[model samples]
Target: MSYELRDHTADVAVEATADTLAALFAAVAEGLTAASAQSVPATPGDRFEVEVAAESREALLFDYLDRLIYERDVRLVLPADHRCTVAEPSETDRTDESDDPDAWRLAASARGVPLDAVAAREIKAVTYSEMALERRGDGWRAYVVFDV
Candidate 1:
């Protein structure tokens, strides 16, 4: 899994590619964290779980990054070390009467350090502009732009 920071007209952007959907998400999430922090602590401080469901893969990526921003602000930390799993709705979801039976789901665990402990920057929000998630050959790629 790898991610690259891209130049945007007036914002920051990231493009990540991985061999699996889960790794793709993890890479993009790491991009978001990299964009937000100048330096993150080497030792873990706080660990958190993030769960997000969306009707589409694009939306799932957006919501997942947005939720990380929310978690960072609320927890006063810079999140990192993302491990994620992305899946389509399963039979159990239908049996459980999920609100959106076709929604894609992402479950992730991450570690973070206090925001004040690092040199951090502000990312106002994750925007849908130029956002993309698609399979390329046998791998997946995701691109996202952040509103600064």
Candidate 2:
């Protein structure tokens, strides 16, 4: 799994590719963190978990990135070492909101150190503009734009 930062007219974009859905998410998360900091200290630090559910894959990606922003803003940390899993609810797992289209859920864990420890940039927010997520052949790719 890998991700690259691309130039944007007025922000930053990340495009990530992976052999599996979970790895793709993790790659994108790392890209987001990279966009904000020059480098993250490899030392161990506080760990946190994030969980999000959305009605579509794109929405899930948007929400996931937004949540990371919220975590950073509130906790004043730069997160790293991301690991995440994405799941689709089965028929048996459906609730009263069964009318909803196929839902996607993400559960992630990562470690963070104080933001002061890293040379950081300001990413105002994650934007829906030019956002995309899709499966290609046996692999998956995700793209996201962050407002600077």
Candidate 3:
């Protein structure tokens, strides 16, 4: 796994890569976690049930990252790991579910400082502007450019 910081006008963007789709998503989520908090310690808690199936892994990656970003912005709930149900892509993308996200279980007693407490790096949005999710000879890789 690898992560790099890129300059943005308003918010910081993270560029990360991994050998598997799961790993790539993990790294991407970790990027958001790092951006939102100072550090990560052991988070003890029930598993949260989150199922997001995109039309493609590329779409899946973006939705996952954006969802995490929304959590960071709204609830300050930074997920340690997303137990995603990686499914086959659908023909039409689904970005909305008329339900509450917090309805999901809190998988752990994770520690996270309030947004104001942290040295907030403004991330305007998670961008697909330069997003890429693909398969290599080894496995899968992804890239996302967050808006500042």
Candidate 4:
């Protein structure tokens, strides 16, 4: 997995690539954390779990990143390590394209440190203004902009 910081007019952006959907999500999560703080703790002091569902792959990525931002803002935690899994919609769950109960489901955990422990930059929110997720030659790539 890999990510690169991109230039955005007034926000922070990240482009992440990975061999699998789950790994792509994890890379983006790590990128968000990296954008927020100068450096993460050598080891995580705590862990938090997250579960989110969306009607499409793009929306799922958007929600996943937004959830991480929400966790940081509300709980005063800095995500340091990440583990995530993406489940494809089951046959029964794929009724309509937009109303599927399991169109995309993400199960993730963020290992973090207390906010006060590290110097951080405020990432106000995650935005859909410039968000995308798509399959590439051999893997997947996602781009996200953070409202700073």
Clashing pairs in 3: 11-122, 11-148, 44-108, 44-109, 45-107, 45-108, 46-107
Order the candidate numbers by TM-score, best to worst.
1, 2, 4, 3
Number of the top candidate by TM-score? 1
Per-prediction CA RMSD (Å): 1.3, 2.1, 6.6, 3.0
For residue 22, model 2's alpha carbon misses the true position, in angstroms, by: 1.0
- Write down the TM-score for model 3: 0.65
How are the candidates ranked when ordered by lDDT, highest leading? 1, 2, 4, 3
The superposed Cα distance between candidate 2 and the true structure at residue 30, in angstroms, equals: 0.4
Q: Any residue pairs clashing in model 1, and if so which?
A: none
Candidate with more favorable, higher lDDT: 1 or 4? 1
Candidate 4 positional error at 116, Å = 0.5
Clashes per candidate, residues 3 or more apart or on different chains: 0, 0, 7, 0
Question: How many Å off is the CA of 8 in candidate 1?
Answer: 0.6
Off by over 4 Å in 1: none
Candidate 3 wrong stretches, greater than 4 Å: 8-11, 41-47, 81-85, 90-117
| Candidate that would win on lDDT | 1
Model 4 residue runs over 4 Å out of place are 92-100
lDDT of 4: 0.87
TM-score of each: 0.94, 0.91, 0.65, 0.90
